[model samples]
Target: MGTESSVKAQAETQIAAVTSLSTPQEGQKNRSSGNFSVENLPAGTYALKFVVEGANSGTHFNVMKDVSGGTDPTIWSHVYSGNTTDVQTDRSFYIANPSGTNSNFTVKVYALH
Candidate 1:
């Protein structure tokens, strides 16, 4: 919040971040099974960034957030490369390589709450 915020800026909020490593049975990687839950987040919008390792399945990845506590695969807000987007209205975020396979992966979120 800078020059146009309706409410006066309070204080410098601490940087919030989390990292998770995808685990799929016995040391292998697979899609749809490797996801990290974004829990204990405050009620506000957040910008997310990701770093994926061992990308053997695909280049294009979709980052989705589970607004609800349940890990419902059908309902997710997804973002990716070539698509300009930010600040998902949520209390939790989830990230994973939907097309990834055969390699261990990790996703980190430098969340601005």
Candidate 2:
């Protein structure tokens, strides 16, 4: 019984350590004013929540991932494209303005564990 108790305690301690290590960092970015870019992200999953404001029904904007930073736009991949609506998606490094003279939006980024 002593041996079993010791093993269980050790297991619990290891689990606690791992839990502490794997805790997600609280890094949130709110881009409520205008277009923005989120760079230097570590290798992990992420969540992007955005709201398209003051755009027409079909005003199309794209959320892209700039793997090569801002130097190259040819390599940008559109991770999300939405009109005037509030939607949540994953993975965004940069945001493009909607196609119109008067169209803009806001985005909120959160790290997912």
Candidate 3:
């Protein structure tokens, strides 16, 4: 494969590792919030990205540790008004999943340091 193709292949794999569908399991209920663990990751710096299936038309989404008055910390909070594709990185922010429940969108982690 060409260099571009090879790089794309690797990226696809890494993306798979970090992507999580919000759809609930067999009999579970759809949650008002979702969580994605970017764990085992060095406690350094990261860029967390979210892609809401076919959303972005003035939709509401948040990525944090608590949605209901929990004292957990938050890193990415916004009311997006555009598609969160690569070109529009303002949709991207820095925040780990904080290891438990309390996420609201598809999150991808990129380590930068």
TM-score of each: 0.38, 0.30, 0.35
Query: Which lDDT tens digits does candidate 3 get at residues 1-113?
Result: 36776642212212212233333334523223334444343343333334443333444444444334545444455524232322112222233322223333444444332
Clashing residue pairs in all predictions, respectively, total 0, 0, 1
Model 2, position 106: C-alpha lDDT score: 35
The lowest-lDDT stretch of 10 consecutive residues in candidate 2 is 12-21
For 1-113, candidate 2 gives per-residue lDDT tens digits of 56876652211000000001111123512111222444343334333233334444444334433343444132222222231222233233344433432534333443232
RMSD of each: 7.0, 15.5, 10.6
Ranking by lDDT: 1, 3, 2
Q: How high a TM-score does candidate 3 get?
A: 0.35
The local lDDT score (0 to 100) that residue 110 gets in candidate 3 is 43
Superposition TM-score, candidate 2 onto the true structure: 0.30
Which ten contiguous residues of candidate 3 have the minimum total lDDT? Answer: 8-17
> Which candidate number would show the highest TM-score if scored against the true structure?
1
Give the better candidate number (2 or 3) by lDDT: 3
Off by over 4 Å in 2: 1-46, 64-70, 74-93, 107-113
* Residue 60, candidate 3: alpha-carbon lDDT: 42
